[model samples]
Target: MRIPQIRLESTKAQIGLKTINAVNNIKQPKADLSIEQPKAELTIRTTPSKLTIDQTQARADVDLKSVVKRMEEFSQKGYQDLLAGIARRAQQGIELMKIENGGNPIATQAKQNSQKPMKEFGLGFIPSHGSVKISYEPARVDIEVAPNKPKIHVNVNKPIMEYEPGKVEVSLKQKNELNIDFEMIDIKA
Candidate 1:
């Protein structure tokens, strides 16, 4: 029997920063400056698998400690910005789904038109003065049945930000069915 290979793909993973307001900036005579950093955290969980087979046979988990370290080196704003962007995108998806689900065309059109710009507003920007951008390559994983092994790869893209602090984490999992090949024989020759 031969085992087939399985592979899965995921969209680019991104993390966002939270807005940091400058409270008080003090400079000592020695050219040392002290500022207050905001306390904000963002947590993002991928949607659970909808398939019953997947729910029982497949599982994937991410280590928050490692993710936090990567995020710390990657983005200061943390995960808030990414969450906001995802939320906006999800809202857009829900609206579109409603339109496709036999909702009123005229009302859907009107809602879409009114919501487009508002959705864009959710992705706030930052100034470049004191803001930092952190990015990481996308992460991928492959599973093979013949070898009964799983391979993982991590890559980070360049982080882009104007002037905010944020963080991001990504995870993925998949299931596959194995097919066996056989030849049919004549029953009564």
Candidate 2:
């Protein structure tokens, strides 16, 4: 049997309008077996103009959920390692605040008084809590296999602090399907 050609579909959306550009049979692989599939590397570029407020908020919620899921999936030691960097940053911020408010007896006394109440109430050292939601889609793969199994990798790049920048990447696997759909959300400045 002859190998089927691979098709590529690309789409771009700006300001709620979408433009699609596609090319097929761009390249052929050398290997031919019971299964034939194409692996793709996709790069999505986004800016503030392309994103809406609702979209950004939804994305952040998804990201936060993903983080929580990851924490649950990983071992305790691994989760601690993942949070160590964030903890260090928070500690630094607290230290800076302390320094800035130093040498004022009233402020010092207030801090002490506040801390005492917090400690008594067992609410001292509150941990940062939040959720991030992201928009993303799984990759599409079309192939023929005796025992069909497909692995899909979806990489998501997310922005932090609206104007500040960041990214998120997720890899997922699926089997026996050629059509996949997903969305990536970006926070605008």
Candidate 3:
């Protein structure tokens, strides 16, 4: 007689993995600026001075009324004395005629002298000095100023960003295998 026996074989399964990392990117931009400047303004004004002079009384000081009055009073007394002398000479002439008519030839022939008027007169004039007036005014000045301000403007831009998602994949590298075998063997006969 012979005896039979059996045999079996087995293999384990294997796995593989693939992975990708996520990525993120960010960017920022600078801002823009603008400015404007304005100029200043100014204004000025001026006025001139004034002056006045008056000479009305200066001309009246040298007029005729004051000078003539003094002269007339001084000469009138001398004129009166001259008239009286003339009258006395006329009376003496009549007396001489009478003497001649009374038959006196020597009296009629005598030389006669007419009286001369006295010159005791004064003429003087003094003028009152004229007055003066003066007036003056100073100059004046005015000034004004105006200024303008500057204008400014600014502009800003938003930030830029980029993002990417992660990915994962899994696949089999080797399959599982199983084997079974049957064998007959005789131990004793």
Is 1 or 3 the stronger prediction by lDDT? Answer: 3
Q: Which pairs clash inside model 3?
A: none
RMSD of 3: 15.1
lDDT of 2 by residue, 1-189 (tens): 333444545444323323343433333334433444554545454432232223433444445446666577577778787798578567656766677566665555456546734344444222223322434554554444344345555444443322323334333332333444444444454
lDDT of 3: 0.70
Error of 3 at 146 (Å): 7.2
Total clashes in model 1, counting residue pairs 3 or more apart in sequence or in different chains: 27
Q: After superposing candidate 1, which stretches have Cα over 4 Å from the reference?
A: 1-78, 100-189
Tens digits of per-residue lDDT for model 3, 57-173: 444445534556657856897788789778967777677667746765444344434334478976644344434466789878888888878888889988898889887878787
Please tell me which predicted candidate would have the highest lDDT against the true structure: 3
lDDT of each: 0.47, 0.47, 0.70
Candidate 3 positional error at 172, Å: 1.0
Task: Name the weakest run of 10 consecutive residues (lDDT summed) in model 1.
Answer: 52-61
Stretches of model 3 off by over 4 angstroms after superposition: 1-8, 37-150, 182-189
Measured by TM-score, the strongest candidate is 3
Per-residue lDDT of model 1, residues 1-189, tens digit only: 444444444454344444446344443333333444444444444443332222211111222335556578468555776888788678767766777677676665566557746344444333322233333444444433332233444444444435443444333333344454555444543
Angstrom error at residue 40, model 3: 6.1
